[model samples]
Target chain A: MTNWQEDIVLDCSGLNCPLPVLKTKKIMDGLDSGQVLKMISTDPGSVNDVAAWAKRTGNELLETVADAGEYTHFLKKRH
Target chain B: MVETAGKKKRMALIASKGTLDWAYPPFILASTGAAMEMEVGVFFTFYGLTLLKKEISPKVSPHSNPAMPMKMPFGPDGFQQIEWPIPNILTGNMPGFETVATSLMKQTFQKKGVATIEELRDICIESDVRLIGCQMTMDVFGFSKDDFIDEVDIGGAATFLEFAAEADIQMFI
Candidate 1:
């Protein structure tokens, strides 16, 4: 998958559920519309939680790549 | 996409337990719901009102909780995976067993990167999730508003019901 240019990179490695999503929302709130964020998390639950959060909050989830136990997600801030 | 009928989704939660295990769900859901753009309110009633206290220290009690698996938080993966089947007699009669259990559970949560209850509550406050303490409970328990965190609003059942009435999801946790 093509890597989208990210305005900020959030490393949530070793953090569990809700923290990753909460921190992601915090940073996303500070970004301009259409800006992309790259979030890396080691929590397995985030694979689904981040997608669900982006969907519910109307953010754009560009891509998610899972390598070993780590998951990398690219999300775009919605207007 | 615009909300259906242009109404924002709302979630109302009634927290009635004060144990360490019981405390996580309400705060976790409240914070997550707020992050999802939903208005969230958690009503702390009965023992749950203790959670709103400024110095919140919830502990796990293994006495009656037979299903709670006891595991060492600090160990190799294989060692950590082994669940020690603690006898009910020992857990029930042993002094300081509850404290040990609470610390072990906390250590496990920390090792697995779970957020503390305080952290989750802070996030909820930051996200504008309403933290409502039951007025009747405080009066019954002889607690003052000063006992709780400043971010919490002290209210009666009616206040929570008003929000829960308009909420899309309501849970008694």
Candidate 2:
């Protein structure tokens, strides 16, 4: 995967369901189009949640890395 | 995407239980749905109306809830820890176990870094999750509109079903 410059890095470790997604959306809402976001979540549900959120919101999923119970995702704002 | 700004997918949930344990599901799903850019609504009915009450911080009653597992203060962090399961016979003998269990649950959630019910409610409201208090339940329970928190809508079953009928996801919790 290409290294896209992350405009925002959201650390969602220790957060359970709904929080990771909610905080991600809140941050993503403030980002400009074409800007990138890097989100790290400890919740396993976020693996599918972030991907689905990207798909549902028309954002571009650039990279994803899962390491030792933590998930890292890079997404670009589409609109 | 251009034409679908306000026309995002919708989700509706019926909250029927008022216990602390029962409160998590509806708000969790509703808040996540809103985060996913969907319109979310949670209709509080029956005993669930207590969830929307302004002064009531609902507590779990382990006296009747046998399914709630007791959590240790520590997680499974590669260190092997022996867990001695307490016999229900012993627990049943202990008085005031319900209060102890309820506080324990709250402590466990705090230790796990999970949000409290108050925080989750705020998140749901901020994320645009519509909170509708069942009017019939309120009337039966002698609760007025002022009994609930701000930003709550009072409605009946038909009102909730209207949103549920068009929602992609409908839940009865």
Candidate 3:
């Protein structure tokens, strides 16, 4: 609900571990530096996984929003 | 472990099993490691070398595994949650039981939105994760380089050790 902007949207709902992170990396690879991506996932594990993946891959995780059972993450591609 | 500045972390995994249930760990870890920007290599040896075949149909046999739960992939939630206690004798002696179990497991994985082993292996290859097949195993099993997918590199133990020695994480699966 915040005013964050994104250059691409990836929906990974119903997918499990590694898939979410894998798909996120695939999309991020195609994005230009500073471009933002909004990814939504239904896997509860992704809450921590996204943060860890962002840190390890040097991407910036702007914020994560949990709405009901779904978790939405906003990430910026690293320069 | 000493952290070398500006060097990517490396992971080395040895896969030695070929069962459907056991085949997942190496590919899953390798692909994920690559996604995390780590250098990853998976050495396939013994029965695990079969996983590198162009057409792999790994089957699960719950005959000796007492802890494996039998669950249906379809039906109502309550029905699906109920684990059927299948006798080991039937699972072990019944012909085509392994095929049934394999299909059921695949169905459950599909229902749960899990990726197939082949899909994960494709991701590993796409991410440049090094897949090394054991040359000794290939010779013993009469497997030629053409028998496996094009992405696999055939090597001996020394090749795997060379990569694993520098790896931050090493696993035997």
Considering only chain B, report the TM-score of each candidate against the true chain B. 0.96, 0.86, 0.96
Worst 10 residues of 3 chain B by lDDT: B1-10
Which lDDT values do the candidates have, in the order given? 0.93, 0.84, 0.93
Model 1 scores a TM of 0.97
Q: Sort by lDDT, best first.
A: 3, 1, 2
Q: For each candidate, what's the DockQ?
A: 0.75, 0.62, 0.55
TM-score of chain B of 2: 0.86
Instruction: Name the candidate that leads on TM-score.
Output: 1
**TM-score pick, better of 1 and 2:** 1
Candidate structures ordered by TM-score, highest first: 1, 3, 2
Provide TM-scores for the models. 0.97, 0.89, 0.96
Interface RMSD (Å) of model 1? 1.4
CAPRI rating of model 3: medium
- Interface quality of candidate 2 as DockQ: 0.62
lDDT by residue for model 3 (B1-173), tens: 12344899999999999999999999889999999889999999999999999999999999967899999999999999998989989999999999999999999998888899999999999999999999999999998999999999989999999999999999999
Model 1: per-residue lDDT, tens digit, B44-113? 9999999999999999898878888888998688998899988999999999999999999999899888
